[model samples]
Target: MAAVRIRIDLAYDGTDFHGWATQPGLRTVQGELQAALATALRLPETWVTVAGRTDTGVHARGQVIHLDVEDEVVIESAGRAKEPPLATLVRRLNGMLPADLRIHRAIEAPAGFDARFSAIWRRYAYRVADQPALVDPLRRHEVLPWQRPLDLSRMNAAATDLLGLHDFGSFCKARDGATTIREVQQLVWERDEAGVAVARVIADAFCHGMVRSLVGCLLEIGDGRKEVAWAEQILAEARRTSSVHAAAARGLTLEEVGYPPDEALAQRAEQTRGRRVLAE
Candidate 1:
């Protein structure tokens, strides 16, 4: 039987899991989800491909993944005759998953849809409460509390200079053989009604540790510790620097991922698979 590609939209509180990927003896979102799916379908263990691999303690509101399984596995009802097999799978998996994780939807994927490679952009938001009064105890898990007050004007000004395509090595954890170059479609700082500082960062893709490192550098500039010119200087270096610390993972959340239309999925995937380099 032919394999069926399934698209799953999920959300998770990453505080408990090690991260998105699975590792020996570690609790992870992928590990738990895969285990639950395998059990529900009565099939062997399977792997999933995610659009974004968030770091430890990072949350995701719009995470996406895809997995391929034999058609028979998806159609098996497991004695639940009331609903279709796909619906049954969703209901059963949700029953087995922990409270912090949720599978929002499951459907047959469009042709050529790849959760990771076909993605056009990923949008993330970082929340920081610079003033003690603005920090809400209920939101402590998702927001970062900082001792110093932040200047929104300064942070926005610094963020403006960092937009557009460029090498972001200075803001990424160095990984061997992985390119540090990325395109920043949007990076803006604003204060919400609650007076908490929010940074909305949209990029074609982010290298490992890129979003938090960018937030850390901007926080310094907002608090008067670093000059506005500092961000530009760091970008010019095109290499990682110790001066920028990755912001606490608790403040970051994967907001959304964008993809091309159904007809263009394959083309987009092909384009993304090519090695990326800054134009000369």
Candidate 2:
């Protein structure tokens, strides 16, 4: 009757859901996944911890979550299949999940595996169709339409000064008792084959609305409305200002989540539990 922790790698089109958390009446990724998991595993209820809690319209390509379930149930889920239990579990999960959501992999978690806390960094990508010709109607849900064409070089240049550890208060929504200090490992803009601008931002952890706000600020510089120094000046002030607009959530996607080696998971989780503060 021992319980086994399971790690799930999945993706979802967040166009219609109300984000990742469960709500009383609204449809959410967490709610849908938990209901499907409970039905597939024949459990009364299920709970999962997610690596990142995305906004309502934001999508995800490489999301991670963890749950604990009875060991017998997992094996029994295979149900006469010759494949491994984990493989069967994933296959069965996908069958039960809605078309917008998918289960890529599901396996027994290693010791100390905590999906949220064990994550070392998260990568998010935002796509913008700055011109009418570049806007594709077929992919309307994931891309944002902008008023002006974006300059990739300008956005990349302006992103350099915002890298490394800094208080991102100007780019984040205020949260009680939460520090906005974060280490931005990467922030670069590039154009896709369709001539749409794409921004890839990676950070140890993002405060609420951090990536969207950063993209909004860089977008102005990319369009020649704001100078490169504006980004640095905002960071130096470390306070939220009206100049930094939060880009549309539909444009942003959680691309990946990085984690340390299995042996370090416990330590990393413990370290992440402490509240962060900027050094004086």
Cα lDDT of model 2 by residue, 96-130, tens digit? 88999999899888999899999999999999999
Error (Å) of candidate 2 at residue 254 is 0.7
* Candidate 1 residue lDDT tens string, 1-280: 9999999999999999999999899999999999998898887787899999988899999999999998887876456567777777788889999999998888899999999999999999999999979989999989999999999899889998899999999998889898888899999998899989999999999999999999999999999999999999999998999888889999999989999999999999999998898899
Deviating ranges (above 4 Å) for candidate 1 = none
What's model 2's TM-score? 0.96
Model 1: per-residue Cα lDDT at residue 3:
92
Computed on alpha carbons, the lDDT of every model, listed in order, comes to 0.92, 0.92
The worst-scoring run of ten residues by lDDT in candidate 2 lies at 271-280
In model 2, state the lDDT of residue 88.
Answer: 85
Candidate 2 stretches with Cα past 4 Å from truth are none
